[model samples]
Target: MASNKPALEGPVATVAPADNLPYGHGLGESGEAERSWGEWNPTEETVRPVRGRHRVAKQRGLARSSTVLGVGVIAAVGAGGIATAQDKPAVSISLPDVIADNLPDATSLPGMGSSSTAERDTASEVLAQAPLTSAGLTAADSEQGTTAGEALRARILQQAEQQQAEADATQKAATETAAAVEAASQAKKQQTAAEKEAAEAKAKAKAEAEAKAEAERLAKLAASYALPTSSYTITSTFGQAGSLWSSGQHTGLDFAAPTGTPVKAVHSGTVKSAGWSGSYGYRTVLELDDGTEIWYAHQSSMTVTAGQKVSTGDVIGRVGATGNVTGPHLHLEVHTAGGAGVDPMAWLNGKGINP
Candidate 1:
């Protein structure tokens, strides 16, 4: 018999004893016998590894926890550092707020992810280095002339207009003066012609009157020199009536004789004039020396021309009442050299003859 080997130290496990059979048998409490081998199909106990030594070293929980810690560190870095920022000048230029509510709260303006401070500084430097361009309107003006040239042109136009106006005024004044002068001349000529015509008419009238007066004086002288045809008694004398005539009294002698008696000249004189008078019709005048004139009026007939010469006692005309006389008698008047008719009877008596 071999000496029994000492059991190794390990954890104890309970098992059933097998019966003695052949090369692979185990003793049991029962007197039966069983067999087993390493080359056989495995049993439950043989297929399992040992408890403490055969455990697996798993890492699923460790991998999950490490990934979560990494995500937390990244979130802390993304928040930046709002609490550690410094105070600086904050500039604000007002514009209409469009996205004020949606805008994120400002932390650090110049963080690793922020661009506000750098962008603002760059813009200010660019503006300071810029140059302003001047306006080009004066160069683009269309007119080529300067303001002085325009002023000169305006003065020239004004002077030309003034000269033209002065010339027009002078021409108008000259025309008016000429017209007025011509009108005044025409009026003067017309007035002179009217005065000349009136003077000619007055001279012609005076000449005619003088010729008529000379002719009458000659006729009266011729008629008075003639004698009545028959002698008769004198009924009234010259200037005998107190209130019988408008000229105070009778101016001639009256003869109470027969009607239609032949009358003759009492003196030698030329037959000068014969005519009708208002108070003494069919009258004649006879003229003598020293310019005395005699009248024989109220006659029926006369046998003499204006220039016929007659002798005293010649029957020149007949006696009749052809005037304002009431009876048939000769109306006679004598005149001085001054041509005023007077009483014929007084002149006849002064001539040494009975009237």
Candidate 2:
């Protein structure tokens, strides 16, 4: 410390004062700096704020324009990799180009951690790879820098993975359940429809069978009343021409009578079977008690429905030569309840009215 120290003046600054002071070098103010450091009468250019604050310059440190540009380029490249590579399509694009387009978003790269893990991870990796001027960055990048990035990237990736897995599981489950339910419902509907159709068919067949059986029964009964008009003459008795008959025996009794002779019923019964019977021409049958049957063949005409009931001696048909008979006549037969044939004459006699 000097003994005769002069009091400092002018703008106060923490910097040390210069030792060399020339006489008559200061401005009108005593002790003013010889060199004009600043002037209040500033030009338009000076009126504007300085290019930057010293504090801000200090913060930037040695981060030059070249360094910033390189960092931006690196960040852009990394970001482009993530953006361009997202859900790769049939075609591919350059990762570097995409990165360049996505540059100038440094803050977001680190902040993206709060968002999707995948995005955060990608942004963090890009951010870390960028030539940074942060306190964490090293001046000597020659020592290969670590792939240091924010934790947001990993978190984003993890979240993405978890969400994708959940979505896949949900989709799979829905597909399986839908298929199963559809199959089950289809089977149930098919079964129900099949059952209904089958039931209806069976019912129809049963009804038809019943109708046929009833017709046959009534026709047999009608035949009973159509016995030979007058036992005038038995032109041919059943079994007379054994080999000539289909059953190796005659199935009916033939009686000779004038053509157009009134045929009458032999017993009280209902008309059952009646129709053209080929060689027998027009024929009819009557059903009686205990399901017994009587047949009439070779008739000139039929005058009754299948289920008409008649008393003995009732006219049922007229004798004719419509069958394989040489003369006009009537043919008759009797059948047991089991369908086995019997002597019609005997069956009539048993009914108390001799044929």
Candidate 3:
């Protein structure tokens, strides 16, 4: 008999002894017992039921547990060892239908034998080394698929660019506004200067016109007057200081000429006197329309009598050496309507005459 040693794997079964059986007759007494091996077949009535079904099930459970424990041990060994066995071909293990159906796959466990340990470790390292942020990526890394960190980085850059553009636009607008204000200010200043210049030109033109009109009026007045005598030289002017006058100063204009030189009326007037006075020889006094008086003294003759109407330039007297006279000269005097004597030279100049 074989030694009673344990089997490496499988379920063990137990059988019970049968009590009824056809015993083989001694040597020549074989009737129903003379059966060949080929003619014998098992029937339901020939075989008896075994009583160890529950025991077999229990043993199967134990065998399945042992298989699971063996697989765990193999996985542990593989994890600690080198992966030299990874190149070996896969092995197909066969199991009983009952065991196979109840067994869980090794890969389904927490840490099992799906791949080599070296391969798994290398994959973990690769995952750890991958960049987590786009900011740290190089140009080559940018070609890779976008991650969450890369997306966030792109959005931030875009927002910053937009804000910078807005700021530049605002600055440009402000510069344009300032330039426009400066232009307007310059225009206003130019307008003010132009207006002031125009006003000055207008005032100058008005002053010129007024001066021209005054000159024209004076020219018309000078036509109505004439000089008192002809062929004479002015010897003494009015307001002269000398001892020959009745007053302390000479108050008349003197015109020296040859004797019998004609003395004419200076303007249209009536002769008020045509006689010799105390110190005036052959004196003639003319009264104008405005009641002003003109005296012509030191005359050689009197051509007009008193109350005679004399026109301008009409002969009224002659030049002679008369009383209170130094030579043959005419002394002429003018008095205002209020009886005040004035300088004859100045009075003639006021009427547009030089002498």
**What Cα-based lDDT does every candidate model obtain?**
0.57, 0.62, 0.70
Model 2, which residues run further than 4 Å from truth?
Answer: 1-228
Q: How many clashing residue pairs appear in each of the predictions shown?
A: 21, 32, 0
lDDT of 2: 0.62
| Candidate No. with top lDDT | 3
- For candidate 1, the lDDT comes to 0.57
lDDT of 3: 0.70
- Per-residue lDDT tens digits for candidate 2, residues 55-164, read 21222211233344345335444445224323333233223343356455544444433455777688899977675543443445335553224333445787999999
Off by over 4 Å in 1: 1-229, 242-244
Among all windows of 10 consecutive residues in model 3, the one with the lowest summed lDDT is 11-20
* Of 1 and 3, the candidate ranking higher by TM-score: 3
Give the per-residue lDDT digits (tens) of candidate 3, residues 181-207. Answer: 999999899999888888888888888
RMSD (CA, Å), each prediction: 32.4, 22.6, 17.1
